[model samples]
Target: MEKQTSANKPHIMTIPYPYQGHMNPMLQFSKRLASKGVQITILATNDVKTSKLAHTSSINIEYISYEIEQGDEIPKSVAAGLGYVNHKVLKRVPGIIEKHKASGSPIKVIVYDSLIHGALELAHKLGLRGASLFTQTCAVCSVYYHVQRGSLALPLEGHTVSLPSIPVLEIEDLPSLVQAHDRLYPGLLEVIKKQFVDLEKAEWIFFNVFDKLEEEIAKWLSSQWPIKTIGPSIPSMFLDKRLPDDRDYGLNLFKPDAEACIKWLSAKATGSVVYVSFGSVANLAQNHMDELAWGLLNSNINFLWVVRETEQNKLPGNFKAEASEKGLVVSWCPQLEVLAHKAVGSFMTHCGWNSTLEALSLGMPMLVMPQWADQTTNAKYVVDVWQTGVWVKARDKEIFTREDITNRIKDVMDGAKGEELRVNAIKWKEQAVEAMSEGGSSDKNIDEFISKVISTTT
Candidate 1:
């Protein structure tokens, strides 16, 4: 396809932090901008060069090739990737910017993942507009903001904590990074800290959230920063159907077993299946995995579980053979499609921000079992704030017994409380639709962002 760039179109480069969870939201946002007649080119790292973003997608995706050794730990590996970008990819961005200029689509704005704060410096040197796109919820970011300001002391003190615009949070409600700052990965903690450091320098700040979803917190956060909640950053087809063909996210890091999963779901009665996924990155321990497997078996409910290839080994021996009658296990299935399916009664997830938003968008009740990062905060909101799902708590030593899982599944699937959860899920789902529809809160923000970019460019 030919490049659609001109002086009037406001060409922008969207750069994510180069992980699947990070890249997916940026790509969805890029699609939204492209629909609004903005010229969008997504900048990705070498790892994403293999992502199956359709060739027919309206947005253009370009890769920055750089290599670094992967460390044993997630935080150290992420840090190394960021270091490579600082040393290698940053050097090449100027040439790419100049090339776009030569092609008559000069890059006017750099909308980057908040984690890669160096992009703001690069934008300043190039005299281009910079926008920070935050992928997490305002609530989670609020906690981090307080941490950055030292308003919320580290190695947390009490049983419960309170902050402005957020409900009182238990020790477990805070992000794991905050809960165990001294014990957990410091590199990731440092990276999260940098997101808020030079944030005031950016021309725009976009959060992948919707106003009504976090009105109080969004209001409070925006008063301090130029925060715009232009999200539920999901595909239009699931929300408003504004972009008719935007059925999937247009990019997938894991090849989904779409046909098999869909065929299985099609046979189940409506609202009969539990759709389980811990997202692309989270890994469950062997004991936890075994317990979860047996829990699902005991629940006696139809379920579809996405166990990444690497993590499948942790499943109990003969678990697959044993579960074949009531469950469908695949490495990955099209999550959005699965969630939207009539047979999927509820979602059992790690409460990753993207997965949480997707379930909300699709009106699926949740069974949140958060592992780390913002997930803990998200799970808190899921159970208490949103009233959409039941939480499956881990017992002593973080062991999620089969009993805990079975009981929670029953709570979400079989009673008056379950019906109430479904009602709340539908309410939030409608709000999400309104936010993405024409003239809605998130749509209005996108329009404002476009107008600002064009006005500055002209």
Candidate 2:
């Protein structure tokens, strides 16, 4: 083991892409590094309100805020908003780095989210090492790399492509970013394409996944660049052994309605409640919301659904009155806590990687309904590879009916099929736990990453 000194200790600056999903994983990784004696500075965008500072008992971790000017009119889609933020962040990077360097804690390395490609150029200007932290699954990264290599084509609509390590996927299974009809399609596609360009310039790349889950893809990616698998980037409370007091990522953009949801779950029967959430970015049309509400009501089962505060008005009229007896709706809830509850038997999700991992780690079966981006790919893995969940198809590639939702929920919660899924979910949960344990693959990978950082600085 190496002893640390103020001058030689690895001081890392980590910047996520200014979104909830991206920020959570980056923050978790920073905490894990801080626990190992590294000093970490987390950079957050001013557009979103976040805690100015977060300190562990050791006080090695700190948060710094930077501002990105916003226009009066908001962007209508997630991809557009991401593009806006990414551009703003790039413009401010050089100044942000200079200011930090003048303050005496010069950054030795920068670990940036893959979406912010401009960081690589900034790193070059400052003569600092740069690494990319991809918050999505390894499979998506492999796919994107091939697309950059000219092996796969964009606007791959109505075509089936097979990759070396991943399952064969239809164009429909690809991210919605490539669709011409998507409002943000062109901007999002360009961003992803440029990401691979900047990826080649990074000193190393890190994936928020484990080797066992994407063994083939992980091996393939290593041939291209220095890569490490250091994830299932969950809270320490859920998987790793940590100080009793080190509990949250403390980076949530939305305040959780944890107490109310927990009380409702306490009154329900074990394995009887359905947990529904679409993650932080996706938005549902009013018709789709109506269908979802009616479907949950029609099933006559207890459900806890999370609708964003902005979208609450989109719910069907009298929905609260009609479903109050059986369903509980909240703007947001403490998801991991809710899923870990014994009362949660199944999940209805948008198949975001974070949400997917949380449900699998808790041994809960899922009804996967992916909306856009890497979520479609995640849905494919949930249904075909893991066999721990069922996929719900939308009619005419638009909206799925209320009946479709009802039947999917009933099939997973009532039939022999449901029992098999439950067994598989429990098996994956055990595997995840084993991976995060002391000698497991994820644990070793993190240790290796820390050692590499220390050696480089020394």
In order, what lDDT does every prediction score?
A: 0.87, 0.79
Candidate 2 Cα outliers beyond 4 Å, as residue runs: 1-8, 46-84, 91-104, 179-184, 394-398
On lDDT, the candidate that comes out on top is 1
Mind giving the per-residue lDDT tens digits that candidate 2 earns over 1-458? 33356766777888887678888888778777777677777676553343533434443343334333455356666566776676666665667668767988777788899898678888877878888999888888777777777787655645677888888987767666644434656456666767778576787788888777788889988888888888778787877656354466666788899899999999999989989999888899888898899999999889999999999999988999999999999999989989889999899999998899888877889999998888988888888888999876552456788898899888888878889999999888887878777778877777776677777767
> Tens-digit lDDT track for model 1 on 162-261?
9999999988889998999836664767778888987888889999989999999999998898899999988888999978878887677788999999
Model 2 lDDT, residue 14, Cα: 84
Question: Which pairs clash inside model 1?
Answer: none
TM-scores of all predicted structures: 0.95, 0.91
Report lDDT (Cα) of residue 251, candidate 2: 60
- Residue 107 alpha-carbon offset, candidate 1, angstroms: 0.6
